[model samples]
Target: MSAVRRLAGFICLLALLAGAVLWITRESARPRESYQEIGLRWLRDEYRLDDATFEKVAALHHAYFATCSQMCRQIKEATRPLLMQTRRQPLSTSTKAGLRQQEQKLCDDCELAAKKHLLQVADLMPEEQRQRFLDDMLSTLETQRLQHDLDMSAHTRR
Candidate 1:
């Protein structure tokens, strides 16, 4: 009887642990638009943007991000078959070359989208406000990059 109870308890504990892990994984994998939204909020607050201007900027930013995401997904889908096939087998020279080409193309596509978005944003803003917005974006990007590097280093140490 005691052995039976111990076995049941162990199973229950395992289930609880699995549930906790799934919850954490789902949360982490969640599509977080908070980074972009918060950036817009900061721009409004720090730059004292009026509500109408803020709304227009936010709309434009959101549209650009949406379009960028769609473009990225399409590119990924296009290369995914070859990429997955290469992953399944040992990499040949040809496979490596194809993969490198795909990777470079992906980078170029994303860069193009980013440049287009920046140009659109610049066109939308006045000269002074545009400079401030650019400055804020630069600082935000630098801070994020530094944080990412720190996180990677910490994980490597661990």
Candidate 2:
């Protein structure tokens, strides 16, 4: 009787352990939401947006982000050659200047696109929330842009 009880308890323990491991594995594999989604949710909650408005906002948000992501990839690709060039040998002053100019152009274009997207998103928000949203976003964007500019300038100098 004791052996039978011990065997039953052992089997149950193994079953429980297996179930836990499976659950953990499944959870680890689950997809996570992007920061864009989190921003959309914040807009909905903070702006007190209706479902219909939220749907429009979400569509615009996603479309803008898709384009934004593509541009980011392009920027990364553009920088790769510059990075490789520097790693292999020192560049001539003019060559370095040209590469830096190309990078600056890409960064400027991205900033413009982001500003345009912010304007479009603000247009969809409530009248009261529109300026506030822009203020919050543009201020944050400006700060980040300035910081990035500073970092790039410092990087180039070094």
Which candidate number would show the highest TM-score if scored against the true structure? 2
- Error (Å) of candidate 2 at residue 81 is 3.8
lDDT per residue as tens, model 2, 1-158:
69999999999999999999999999999998889889889889998888988999899988988889988897777665556555447677787788788877888899999999889988888899899889999999999889977866665554
Candidate 2 stretches with Cα past 4 Å from truth are 1-5, 83-88
Question: Which candidate leads the pack in lDDT?
Answer: 2
For each of the candidates, give the backbone clash count.
Answer: 0, 0
lDDT of 1 by residue, 73-103 (tens): 8666745544455334655667656765765
Clashing pairs in 2: none
Candidate 1: stretches off by over 4 Å: 1-33, 74-89, 135-158
lDDT of 1: 0.70
Candidate 2 positional error at 79, Å: 2.6
TM-score of 2: 0.82
Tell me which residue pairs clash in candidate 1. Answer: none
lDDT, residue 7, candidate 2:
100
Q: Give TM-scores for every candidate, taking all chains together and pairing residue i with residue i.
A: 0.53, 0.82
